[model samples]
Target: IAQRAMEPWAGLMRSFRAHRDHVWCKLSGMVTEAGWRHWKSQDLQPYVDAVLSIFGPSRCLFGSDWPVCLVAADYQSVKRALDDCLSGLTEEERSQILGASAIEAYRLPL
Candidate 1:
């Protein structure tokens, strides 16, 4: 049998559901070529909601990409980019995205 074609959405959902093995969602490069350029400034609520729909909230994470983010916005601007999207989520979810998810995923000592 031949290999399956790359379906980005299906693939992403599959990875997200594998949360039993891996927790946390870094939405850094998830958008399209054009979309990535605009993602930082645009309302990312839909995409954030989509991830919540598939993976729930506890597994989400935030990353600035610092250097990569510079392609779209300044370091501080990109670093603060997720503030709006995250406003709708619960405190627990925010905790995960801010640090808990990374701590768990990397098995880091906190």
Candidate 2:
């Protein structure tokens, strides 16, 4: 159902959904979204996979919400959780998600 709904708008939705050259931020808030107490890296994998599928590694960036993420886990825990979710990716792909994508997406100077 959700997939169907997104198909039609997929192209235009690139602004946030990640299509073509558009990028996406795979950031904090997963723990709360997955239920804080029971949240695990596995619980976030499906979502992470979906974003990676939609955006591809070259168009995805990692972001941290800092104090907001503190509601569920410390900064290190959040980083670990995202790292675990992305553990299966190739080193280059991981590099893209970790920083390269942001640099390209925002056209930031080196």
Candidate 3:
């Protein structure tokens, strides 16, 4: 399994959380690690939980991974997977992952 497999990074995520003010995590480019043809939203939940648990919604942003992700999943599927993974969170947290975090991270001119 590659580094993207998510299990090994739980500890790293914890370590990284110490720098949460200076670090950000983009929830993208991971679906293929669950396997291109067989991946399901359930397979994605643990990874999402890890990040949200470690970084919280304010430190995360959704990423489509675009043409690269096309190797395993499409744009809508990627979004839906994140939505499923985020189901237990409050609406504001979900919104943070979907858009606001990116805006804050990049200091977007919105």
Candidate 4:
């Protein structure tokens, strides 16, 4: 599905038109997909990159699935994993993925 969505002829962008106002969480389900016991940032980078490419920094938010993530890694470890995957992004783009996008997406009063 990720590959299909990334294809130019798949009309993924057109599908996104209906969700133009929505933001996408680049986190979630990664640890499980990568394998709970033997996951690394490198293992998850392809999936993360795909999402970032499709959604761009402005519409992509980071999510720390907390207790769920704990089953695979510690809180800091999970965060560091994502940080590693996002290492090449600019500071502003990182900020968007880390927090700014979530604020906008959720319409928070902060």
Clashes of each: 0, 0, 0, 0
* Candidate 1: tens digits of C-alpha lDDT, residues 41-93: 34555566667666666666677676765656666665465666677778887
- Which pairs clash in the backbone of model 3? none
* Predicted structure 2: lDDT: 0.73
User: Please, what are the lDDT tens digits per residue for candidate 3 over residues 48-94?
Assistant: 88888888888899999898888889999988988998999999999
Higher-TM-score candidate of 1 and 2:
2
Candidate 2 local Cα displacement, residue 86, angstroms: 0.7
Q: Name the 10 consecutive residues with the lowest summed lDDT in model 2.
A: 1-10
Highest TM-score against the true fold, candidate: 3
**RMSD to native for every prediction?**
6.0, 4.6, 2.1, 4.0
Off by over 4 Å in 1: 1-23, 30-42
Model 3 ranges with Cα > 4 A deviation: 1-6
Candidate with the larger lDDT of 2 and 3: 3
Instruction: Give the higher-lDDT candidate: 1 or 3.
Output: 3
**Candidate 1 clashing pairs, residues 3+ apart or interchain:** none
Alpha-carbon local distance difference test for all models: 0.61, 0.73, 0.85, 0.75
Report how far residue 33 has shifted in candidate 2, in Å. 1.3
User: What stretches of model 2 exceed 4 Å from their correct place?
Assistant: 1-23
For candidate 4, write residues 1-110 as lDDT tens digits: 22223356225654674467554655665675457777888887877787776678888888878778777888888889989998999999999999998888888998
Worst 10 residues of 3 by lDDT: 1-10
Clashing pairs in 4: none
